[model samples]
Target: MLGKLLKHEFKETWKLPVLVCVLVFAVFLATYWYLGNIPPAASEDEISMAAMMAFLLFTIAVICGNFALLIYLAVRFYKNLYTDEGYLMHTLPVTPRSLILSKLILSSSWMILISFEIFFTIFPVMERFFQLLSTDPQISLYTALGEYISISEFVLLVVVSVIISSISSMLTIYASISLGQLFGKHKVLASVLCYIGFSAITQIITSIFMTPYMVSYVITLDTTTAAAASFQFWEFFRTILWIGVGISAILAVLCYILTEYIMKKCLNLD
Candidate 1:
């Protein structure tokens, strides 16, 4: 049942992400081809530096465009989840658990895919740019990725961040809409009000608790110079792991309960 639900959800949500991927690829190809044949008057190192800077600028532009598309996708998903379509959606043979599961899984999966698409989409442009500047047979063609930064950890962080952030955002929307629908004859306004209310409550709670919580976590870590020198990468991961996982679990359960409540108790399809 969850699988079937996800299949339909994927069908509905895939278009925008796929189109973004295509556009990113096209941009990369165009940049690569244009820069490849254009001989620069500058020395090899200068040309390399210029090409790298150009790639960075282009990347920033693409990321900004990707963010806009992400906003559109989020709005579309929210509308599909909240409006009359949800009535028809909930009427299916599947339970609320399955429906919620589908949305979470599908949306999270796309988030991960988008993360990868962003990486691979830029690789060709970068690769070609590097090749154009390579002048020596001794100089290996493989890019010095490590020189910039340790990308493995960064990549994992990005993937987890995207999935967690997307799901969390969706949960807020679902909870707001659910709370809103409880008010008769003012469902839309109710939703907006609920969202604002939720935001205020969240901010208050976070403000009151965030500092103490972070301080406590910091205290547990080694403060001594010796311990500080011995700090491990896993330490950072462990610190954030529980918080991220806990928030994910909390939001998942909240989305489920609120969605179920809305479906069973408050939903009035027009």
Candidate 2:
């Protein structure tokens, strides 16, 4: 039953994310083209500077596509399971847990796919882009990044961050939309408010608790030695990264339970 739900959900949701991925790759190709055509004196030209700004916007667009995908799916969840259609859906033999699991798994999978997409889509162009501006012959992405951390560590960080953040985000959205079920009218507005409230709360948590601790660790690092400072800074960065990951995991679980409990208690077919 879970397998069937996953397949159905994927078929329904795949088109938009797939289209977003295609558009991201299209933007990447344009970036690659611009990088390949740069003349030695191009950096001096105002037109080239404008093009660089456009390139950065293109990279930002690639990332924004991920958010857009999540937003669309969030809406889909609310409409399918909490709106007029939900009565039929709830009548199905599938358990609510399985239904939620299917959506979570698919959302996380697409996010991971697009995370790697953004990384690889931009990675090949990074070396060329930096080399065009950098004076050092030894300047490569690996060497530049190696100053702070090893290439392996950076990759691991990206992967871990992607996985944890995606799941956390999906569960948050699910929980927020689920919360709307408790409201009698203007459920959509209620969901939006719930999402905003959750965002604010999480921001407060990081601002008040996690970020200060991370900043304190970085500020306390020994400054006499440049090498040691870099190591310690990134080490603290990783420490904060894991702490954030733990918080996200906790948030995800809480949201999951919140969603299930709300569905069981307050779900209204009327």
Candidate 3:
């Protein structure tokens, strides 16, 4: 039953995800080509302006793409399970738990997919761009970043971070929307307000929790101990990363439970 639901959801939602991926690739490739083709004698203003425009487009493409996908997930969930279509959906043989699980699984998968696309699509092009900008034949992408960790470890940690954060965010929205459905009217508005509140609380909590670790890393001494400082920074960063990952993972589970409970016991698809 969950399998069928996932299949149906994927069939309906694939277009936007694919389009976003295409747009990201196109934007990155266009930026790469433009940089490589810049005239040898181009003015500083010209180069800077062009590069800035490219970067701005790249930023917009990545951000808007993911934002659109996230909103689409919420819209589909609401329409399919809480609106007119929900009448038919509820008549299906599956339980509300399966319905919610299908949504979460699919949503998390798409979130991870978009994160992967953004990281890989921009990395190689940006790597070459940096090397060209510096005119250093030996300048590799790993030159600065490899100081504290191997590329594999860096990539692994990045993927782990993305997965945890993405699922946490999606589940938070799902839980917010589920809770909002209980409202007698203006459910969408209620959902938006709930989301804003959730975001605020989350930000405050995460900040409070991370403050000690952050301060410990920041209060250390001066420039004479550059290497030591860098090591301290890395330790600080690792601690922060793990802390964030832990918090996000816990939140994701709680939100999943909240969403499922709402779907199962408090659902008011009016």
Candidate 4:
């Protein structure tokens, strides 16, 4: 039953994600073609300027496209599960948990997919820019990545963080929309307000909890104390990563419970 719900949800929601990816890929290819053709005889300064401008434009497009996709997903979730269409959803022979899980899984998958698409799509442009700088054109992506940290650990951390963050974000929106259902009128407006309120509260709580550790970490690096002291950067980063994961996991669970309770017990379909 859960599988069927997921299949249906994916089928309905895939079009937008696919469309966004296609458009982003098209832009990336066009930009790459235009920029990669710059003649070697062009002044180095001029080439540098053009490369920077092209990178900026490509980055802006990717960011905007990703944000638009997220907004579309959130709107779809609200419309499909909270609007008049919800009348059909609630009547389906499925548990509230299953339905919510289906949406969560699909939304998180799309978010992760879009994130990867944005990264890989722009990678060629970045590679070309590096080449123009007379840097090692043979540099592997992993070699560039190694300058930061252990690639495997960092990649794992990133994947986990993205998944958890996506789930947390979608669940927050779901919970907000569920709360808005309590209103008898202007439910969409109410949902928007709830989302803002929830985001503010979450931000405040996160700042209170995470700011100290982050500040301490920054101070250590800024003063060069980390080098003098027996500080392990990887250990510190891993701790922070796990802390964030824990917080996101807890929030995701709470939002899931809230959404499930509302849909099952207090759904306002009128």
Model 3: per-residue lDDT, tens digit, 41-117? 23323334555566668778888988998998889888888899999888899998888888888888988999898
Q: For model 4, how does the per-residue alpha-carbon lDDT over 12-118 read when each residue is reduced to its tens digit?
A: 88998998888888889977886787543244354567767777898898998889988998898888887788889989999999989999899988888888787
Candidate 2 lDDT over 1-270, as tens digits, reads 999999899998999989988988888888878776774234433245644665687778886897898888888888889777787789999888987898899988888888889888787677767766655546788675688877887888888888988899999999988887778888788988999999899878866667677678767878998888878877887777877787788888999999988777777755
TM-score of 1: 0.60
Q: Report lDDT per candidate.
A: 0.65, 0.81, 0.81, 0.81
In terms of lDDT, model 1 sits at 0.65
Q: Report the Cα lDDT for residue 51, model 3.
A: 53
Off by more than 4 A, model 3: 39-47, 132-137, 225-227
What's model 2's lDDT at 152? 85
In angstroms, give how far residue 3 of model 1 lies from its true place: 3.1
Query: What are the candidates' C-alpha RMSDs?
Result: 6.4, 2.5, 2.5, 3.6
Q: Candidate 4 — which pairs collide?
A: none
Q: Candidate 2: misplaced stretches above 4 Å? A: 40-51, 225-228
Error of 1 at 58 (Å): 4.2
- List the candidate numbers ranked by lDDT, top first: 2, 3, 4, 1
Query: After TM-score superposition, what is the CA distance of residue 191 in candidate 2 from its true location, in Å?
Result: 1.0
Residue pairs with clashing backbones, model 1: none
Error (Å) of candidate 2 at residue 206 is 2.3
For each candidate, give its TM-score against the true structure. 0.60, 0.89, 0.91, 0.83
